[model samples]
Target: MKLFNWPNIRLVLMFSLVVFLFSFTSNRNSQRKVAKSTVIFVGNIDPFINQETVNKLLIENNQDPQSIGKDKLDLNKLEKSLNGHEMIEKSDVFVSIDGILKAVVKQKTPIARVFNNGHSFYIDYEGNTMPLSDNFTARVPLVSGEINKKNKEDLADLFRIIYDDAFLKKNIIGAQIMPNGSLLMFNRNFNYQIDFGRIMNLEHKFKNYKAFFQKAVLDSSLYKYKIIDLRFSQQVVCTK
Candidate 1:
């Protein structure tokens, strides 16, 4: 009986050779030069920043892209650069064993574009203000007027409501914050604007509007009036 078969010996030798080659390649690549960086955008966001910009950021932050050692690189610093970008919400940076550097970036979700105090910016889903991007413009609803700490949450909720509702998203093109903490939405279908006063009891307010809209649409009287008011406690008010 053979203690060790020829097939087993061949398999063992092949494995040893593979391991040796991997080790040799790894050692050689230990003094790795990061190749051109790859930018991966996560999610369905229309990227506010492009791959070229991301690569530029990486190059600038990497200190010396020509440096021959991934270990010598402060990868965290590179990641920080991407994270600090106004349009970027979060990011991950890493180098493959083959010296390919990949940067995964998640862009901030802009729920509404705000025009306040003669300045324009984007308001993210988290209610944080994000700087406008020169590369791309978000198609989210436009919002104008002043905001205070008291009505910010209510306003944020309104933005979310518009974003989440298909009919509202399609119909509401813009919004205005009133002095009395009410919201006014621009109508896309009709010439009239919606005075959606406060977001309190939002569900009922929307239900009232939806019902009224459906009724108005049925009789072809949608264009007869201006301004749909949904603020007076579960009632739909309109004027000609």
Candidate 2:
């Protein structure tokens, strides 16, 4: 029994040494190869953030793959740099087994663009304010006139509801903020305004609007009204 155990232990040690040597040699060869270029994958281009812009950013910072080697590349640092950009919502950088460096970036999506007192910016989906991009302008709902940064979070909630509904999203094109902090929405196809007062009882207001809208459409009176007020409690008032 002692003789058999000694032979088995010797064979196991020899196999482990062979595996370690092979792994070490393969790792050394990988480190010797330098990254030639970066492969970028953008999930949503949205005209704001593009592949060229990301590549240019890396080049400007001297972090481009052309200057990076597998042995010296810091994936965590690269990812952190990309995430620091306001437009980039998230980013991932990784070096493949074939010595290729790849980066996947996702840009933020804005639901509304605001313009007030010559200042312009965007409200992202998460209710965060982002500066307007010089590269491209998103075709989202434009909010102009008296702007209140304090109620932006509430406004973002309203925008989310309108943007989510396919019917409302297609119909509303812009909005105006009244001095009383109420919202006035403009229709794209019709020459009418929706007086969407403060952010209260949103579900009830939207439901009333839908019911009234369906009734108006059935009666062929959609274009006849000039103003639809949904500020009341479970009631829709139209002015012609």
Candidate 3:
């Protein structure tokens, strides 16, 4: 082929460089657009956890996920804040790629009320103390006694045992605490008392009650009895 023209060669090289540079610039701009539009996904957040509260906490500490150079979001702190409320038993928080935050909350369920010395407190099924509400009425067992500061734990334990026992819980109408720290249960039918002491080996004591009631009380014409003692290990004593 004839010797290539220098001017034409220079023009061809310049066109090639221009095309390469344009493509490189376009790719860089595209990449930057994608980076700016990056989103995060968060889930499992309760609706009750206000978005404004989360924003405030995040902004105060410069922990917002959306902010450049901001500290990573502290999941533990967020969860603690949500769970600190008396009404919330459990809570979860989630962050989305699109900078959305989600929160979910589980409310405490009260199963019974403990009346001690005049002040009343609610006990949940899981043996946790729940704040009493005037608007809410629960048809659970009522426990009353000469309760002191030390007696609260014992009362909570008693509630836990009773709630776990299906047979005794169904039959129990209410519970009373004797001066000796013993528990007296009131049944739905017939004015009788069940002496369940301190709730040690509760499952075993409950089983004993079931066996005795099925054999002696259910079949017998004795619908009325004075007291049924389930305090003894593996034995039930009835006083008529």
Candidate 4:
């Protein structure tokens, strides 16, 4: 049998230690490079969520990747922070390898102006009540009369008619809600009144108005008529 050599065992142990040290040093250098090159991408963020705010929050919360030795920045917390604002509709965030941040934002679009009691609010396309801003003016039809409670569905339906029905939208300047829940439309150009009751079968009613206007008003000199009542189904009454 060959004899076991103590010096040979020591040499082998030393070589293994050297290899481990080299690997550890290489890993440390790779980590350092990654830490030096990191960038952040922030999307759907407004000017309110500026660079200073981001820097302050990150530094205050100790969320900076460089401070924590992280390969990627945690954008979830940043997004949550931005979404806390009432004006922010949506926000997205991104990060690059060089530690730079990019942000993009989408804002809510108002569809109509809603008034209740003495205060006024904007109704967006989605029928959500948006607080009026001093910086921007909403270019939408005004609604008034007995609007005390929230009526998103009714308001949305009215907006749909305004957007889809071309002739009616052009002719109608404003809408009023009666105490008994009937809808009244006023024409600005013609100085006529349209009594649209309770929005039921509105599509059919609007179609009838189109046909009646083309045949009765446009074809003849009936613009002098004061009221065009289409509240009753299958009939249109014009008063001079």
Instruction: List model 1 lDDT by residue over 139-239, tens digit each.
Output: 88998898768777777787888788998878778998888777888878789988887768887888788889988998878898888888887578998
* Ten residues in sequence with the least summed lDDT for candidate 2: 32-41
**Per-residue CA lDDT of candidate 2, range 1-240, in tens?**
576698899998999999999999888865655555464556557768767767665552565666655777767877887788889888887777777667788888788899999999988888888788888888789998765677877888887887788987887789998888888989888787999898777778878887888788887798888999999985799999
Root-mean-square deviation of Cα positions for candidate 2 versus the true structure, in angstroms: 2.4
Please rank every candidate by lDDT, starting with the best: 1, 2, 3, 4
Q: What TM-score, over all chains together, does every model reach?
A: 0.83, 0.88, 0.62, 0.63
Clashing pairs in model 2, backbone N/Cα/C closer than 3 A:
none
Badly placed stretches (over 4 Å) of model 1 are 1-26, 60-62
What number of backbone clashes does candidate 3 have, counting pairs of residues 3 or more apart or in separate chains? 15
Per-residue lDDT tens digits for candidate 3, residues 176-201, read 88888878888887677898887467
Lowest-sum lDDT 10-residue window in model 4 = 37-46
Off by over 4 Å in 3: 1-77, 97-100, 220-222
Question: Model 3's lDDT to the true fold?
Answer: 0.65
- Considering lDDT, which of the candidate structures 1 and 4 is the better prediction for this target? 1
- The global Cα lDDT (0 to 1) of model 1 is 0.83
Candidate 3 lands at a TM-score of 0.62
Candidate 4 lDDT over 1-240, as tens digits, reads: 444588778888999999999999766644542233222334322232334444454431764545543334556876676555454566675544454454444555566687769988866666677777655675567888765445557767777677566776676667888888888777766767888888677777788788888887656655778788878888988878
Better of 3 and 4 by lDDT: 3
